[model samples]
Target: MKLLIQNLREYLRADFHPRLYLATAAWLGLLITLNYTFDLEDVYIDSLRGSWKRPVLYILLYTTVYYVAMGLWTYYHHRPDLWRNRRFWLHTGVGWVAYGFYAGFYGYNRWSEQLLDGQIYLFAYYCLSNLHSLVTLVLPLYLYYRFFDNGAEHFYGLKPKRDGLTVYALLLLIMVPLIAFASFQPHFLDFYPTYKDTTANEFLGVPEWVTALVYELCYGWDFVPTELLFRGFMVIGLSRITAVDKNQSGVILPMVVAYASIHFGKPLGETLSSVLGGYLLGVLALSTQSIWGGLLIHLSIAWLMDGAAFVQQWAQQPAGLTP
Candidate 1:
């Protein structure tokens, strides 16, 4: 832990810029307030759900989020280089496209038709939605990495070593209580243990725990693409290009604010935490040149929260009944 702290201190000392950081905070804060005030994701994004137009809207949305974050950097630092750099545009522009594909993907809405008379339609809906990140984010991003970035070493910090494994585990352990506390918030249980409403177990003649396990795994899988994009590509990949000032890689804050924007659909508390979480993970990724720690921390916290939701729901069930 001390080693991790030292590394973070070094990153902060070397990379911190007051103007860029403050401007990013003020800009992102306002957007976050407006989004939560009006429920913009559901109100505006979902306004075109299932239509061909939605992905275009999402591309525009994420592009705006990313560009403004970078724009703030350019504005505060007075550097036209990031604007002139084609690599920045290539990296972020493609990201907006991939995010749009994932955010607007409704092809899974039809997945039930391929199953047994759509008997497990809700099951298909929940499970497929969780797994769609593979096609939407992974497939495109991987292609870009191989062809565009020329196959970065350790494949964007996907090393097999046990480096910092203990710290990642400690991070996960610390979040357990926080996850438990948040599970009791209004509308929390209704939204989590995402398979709670799925009748896959009944259709398959198995216990609900079976379906829960399946959905939880898929729920956890969704974060792979997330870590890969934000920590691996955004922080690690973009760092090599020297953003912000001529000698700085302070795009971590920029990535955090943009990352937080994507969380606008969730509760305000959750959205707010994303900024802090993204910064910590981004620092580690930048320091170690590995996203493995971020992936471990991210997936563990997510599954832990989902697990807490499951336990809460189970305790509420009748003595002789099952979900």
Candidate 2:
């Protein structure tokens, strides 16, 4: 127990930067204000159905608000050196452009499915469809890092490191039962198994399990872009441009705010919890310089929550019957 506590302490060091906090607060405040002012969260969710206007407004609002907040934070903190860093502005520009591609691709794919047509195989279509995020968010940064930057591995947080693997493992162990406990809530079950369509089953003329296999794989891969964008690019890549020391990364909380904002369309509880979860994951990525652990933890929670929801749905069925 003593050794275990030591290991946890070693990995879980507190990183509190005043400017980062202020910037995060401003970012969150802007999101909350917009959400309350116009019910933007619901509007944004509605946009996924067919309205391009709301999403475009959201992307514009988000980028403008966040960059303004960051600029003010840098000025107030008197970090003219950071402000003058051409790499800083360059990287920030790349990140926002990447975000535009992310939001655009997500909105496009979510609202329109024409690009996903013409696949002869069901699983192939599923796999290709999953590449939507990879193509938009991950590929642009990846290509830049690989070709322009001359390396895509470490900058993208793909380098292998075991620094905090134990802490992450322990956290995952504790999280599993807590996630199961949450799964028992009616609201939780209603929101999960997020792969609701199941149209693939009928389209492929295959059993539900077969379709599930494809859906889960695609769903799991969805996080790759997520991690790459937030943890890899925003946190790690931005650190190179903004870090003042080994321990302090100015970009962490800003990334957290943006990461949490992306969850605005989710359930309120999950969306709020994302702030904390995103922060912790961002810290881990910075400390260990790898996102694979976070990837594992995210997939574990997502798949487990999905499994729990499935189990609850099964149990709710009438006396030993299959749906």
Candidate 3:
């Protein structure tokens, strides 16, 4: 912990550019949230099944705006310097990877008729989901470049260290019980009252591997974007706003709130789980300075939980198989 503080100090001392990057991102996010709250007029739901649209356009538009706003804000704020740095490419590349993971998988699911079918609602959900992904990827890169890249001190007093083994061990320990519980007592945990009992085979009509891949591509992909938004972007962005010396507690506040708010309509148990999960991810992001770790964990959990449901359903089929 002492070493972490020392490293953070070194990173922050190197570069301290208080541009509109963080503020712009926050404002855009606020705009979308507010729009959703007030202009609920645009919302659309399927008539028969009451599903949202396959790919919610409003949501996508909002997300696109947010990403464009952040990019433009960053480019304008640090034009000459950012142009000169090769790290810009690295940052952009990472952002694209994150985006691809989000859009490709989600898009596939949207195409496969697995997602909500109400056009407006679907659009909103997709947009928000993608926005979350974009924030997660870009926010950290922004912080790393703005502060840590130049050996500057961080406000959160966090230092990035690569302790792969420790991370694996922690992840394993945390996940083992969850998996066990889900297997034996799936009813004990219900994050969303609207939960669907979807199975890979039933949904995709294929073998285990193919069904798993499809499921992962569609549902599992959203995990990355979700983590990126709450844990990656919100956490780091808030840290920058508050400054590091304010204490670790302050640093994680935004992340926790954002994480919980994202699940506003979810069940109490789910919301509670989200709070705990968000905090855990925030800690991991802060400790490692790598959103990738959180993303991996998020994706893994999603896959396991969703996959388990599929497996269970498959086991109960008349032929012990999916359609």
Candidate 4:
């Protein structure tokens, strides 16, 4: 018990790192958890299709709000150098561009399908499929570049290292529970319900493989931007505001908290899992100075889980499943 306490203390005071990201994450997590638990209907998916204007506007609003808040915090609390890194701007710009591409491409495709075929399910499938793809493919690479390769040495004051075995082991350990919980807990809301619904239909006149392939193309593109904005941009940006030393545990805390909060609308178990998962990912990034490792593991687990769920649902359906 004494040793455990000491370790806990050490983890908290281990380094000069930012806590703002973690704090924001925690707040977001709490908000999501509360909304989920209470069945709050305030959260709405930006389901506007057709025009790029609405989607672009929404993205701009979210990014601007996030940057403004972060900028203010940095201005008041820390020196200008911390917030004025040129690499930060470049990374952010690239990330936004990625986000725009994803939203525009996926959104337009879905709208076109809906307009031409009047297939609401296709539109839904596109959204979910795209989300899953993006989370799996693009997010990790963006994270790798932004957090690990781009500014790791400068901010963390540490050299880059790579250990594939360690990363794989850590990823496996973290993902095991996420998989178990997702499988067993029916009460927990699946993040991509529309996609799940569409995929469950085995006989929609479209081959399953073809549907999956198309979904992957759009989804993969979108996944990159999401990772950049949430994990890459948010985590790295907040690091500037909090200014926690990278050598110690403080650096990991904020990232963990922020990561967790992003999954707020999930079940308690899922929410907690995300927090732990975020910590593990952060640790992986810190140790290896690479997001690729983390992203690969993340994408693998996500695809596996989604595929499993789709298969399970399809198997359970009666002979004629059409939706």
TM-score of 2: 0.82
Candidate 1 segments whose C-alpha is farther than 4 A from its true place: 115-117, 243-247, 318-323
RMSD of each: 2.2, 4.0, 11.1, 7.2
Tens-place lDDT per residue, model 4, 49-145, is: 4456544644563355345444534543454564467655565455544554444334435544565344445545565545543543355444655
Candidate number with greatest lDDT: 1
TM-score of each: 0.92, 0.82, 0.48, 0.58
- Model 3, 113-145: lDDT tens digits are 445444334333433443444444455545555
Better of 1 and 2 by lDDT: 1
lDDT of each: 0.79, 0.69, 0.46, 0.50
Error of 3 at 301 (Å): 1.0
What range of 10 consecutive residues in model 4 has the weakest lDDT sum? 152-161
lDDT of 4 at 319: 81
lDDT tens readout by residue for model 1, 1-323: 77578767877776667987888888898889889888878898888868988888888877888788878777765666778888878887887799877888887877655653466888777788879888888899888888888646656677655666677777778778888899987667766755555667888999877887888888888888888888888888778775443236656877888899888877778888898888888887777778888898888888877778878877889999964
Candidate 1 Cα RMSD after full superposition onto the native fold (Å): 2.2
- lDDT-wise, the better of 2 and 4 is 2
lDDT of 2 by residue, 6-87 (tens): 5235433444446656656766877766775677756654556445554465567557655765665466555668768877
Residue 214, candidate 4: C-alpha displacement in angstroms: 5.4
